[model samples]
Target: MQCVRPLWGLTAAAVCILLLLLLHCHMLREGQLSAGACEVVTLDRDSQPRRTIARQTARCACRRGQIAGTTRAQPACVDVRIVRSRQWCDMSPCLDHEGCDLLQNSSGWTCTQPGGRVKTTTVS
Candidate 1:
């Protein structure tokens, strides 16, 4: 009985930690949304683009009506209306032979050629 109680307590602690992490992320997201500038979260290929509070990278920032995006594997500020249109892949962003995969966040996408070459395009 004593061993079971300790195990249950450990499980509850783990759940609490997870919930705290989620809450922190949510707060961070809410705060960043109101910021006028864009922030670069990660430069890695295997991750999603997340907004941060810092203003260190000027290139990632967008204009008032625009949002952080990427063009041809480079950071760009795309118009908000265009982003919502959901027609990015139709614009042939990738090479003629490569396939374009739009990311869920609409922040950027990845282009993959038949030879397994992958290019990750990311926004702030």
Candidate 2:
């Protein structure tokens, strides 16, 4: 019937869209996609404004198992493994007045006390 034909077309279109979404998700899961979720933040006050407000700042609002990191020199969501592979101590692995040294292997970090002694070794 003519009505049946229209209904079937709508269903087919929906299926196609769903397939595309699934494929995109698969690519993201495989770390083949560079895309990430971004969010906006707003601040308001009833009192007088302070000095001034800058244009805006951007940061990655990543999903679970993901952290804000740089990819291709651009802000992006990266896996925790990728972050740990580097020696930068962005995670604040060490407490105040302590020094953090990344292990040779990317498995963990070590903290040094103020007296330059090994305080603790955190194995990831």
Candidate 3:
């Protein structure tokens, strides 16, 4: 029947589309296609503007010493170096004479007093 022929054609088209989608997904999983690079961003928190944050990239894995982070905008990789480069202290206020220091082996920064007292802020 003519109707049956059209139905078969449609079915074939649909199957082809499904197969294409599956192949695309498989390529993405295998990293043959680049999902995208994670973006560094600054966020606003508690009425303070411009706090640096890393959001995890979609379908991407971070390198060593980095963790996936999510923001309102997108996902990125978070690390101590990224936080320090963003100047964590400028966003976080410290005591009159306290200085902000980036933790060497962590994904956060610390406010250090002259007497060695430290207040740490962790970014996820």
Candidate 3 pairs with clashing backbones:
55-75, 55-76, 56-75, 56-76
TM-score of each: 0.37, 0.36, 0.35
Candidate 2 backbone collisions, by pair: none
What C-alpha lDDT does candidate 1 achieve relative to the native structure? 0.64
Candidate 1 wrongly placed segments (more than 4 Å): 1-59, 90-97, 102-109, 118-124
Q: Write the per-residue lDDT of candidate 1 for residues 1-124, one digit (tens) a residue.
A: 9899999999999999999999998997775444344455555333346523222233354667876554444445677766677656644567678889878877767789899877755544
Worst 10 residues of 1 by lDDT: 51-60
Candidate 3: where are CA atoms >4 Å away?
A: 32-85, 88-100, 103-124
**Best-first order by TM-score:** 1, 2, 3
Which candidate, 1 or 3, would have the higher lDDT against the true structure? 1
Better of 1 and 2 by lDDT: 1
Residue-by-residue lDDT tens digits, candidate 3, 52-97: 4333224436667654543322455556464546555543345567
Q: Output candidate 3 Cα RMSD.
A: 11.2
- Total clashing pairs for each candidate: 0, 0, 4
In angstroms, how far off is 27's CA in candidate 3?
A: 0.7
C-alpha lDDT (0 to 100) for residue 62 of candidate 3: 67
On lDDT, the leading prediction is: 1
Alpha-carbon local distance difference test for all models? 0.64, 0.59, 0.58
Reference-based lDDT, residue 9, model 1: 97
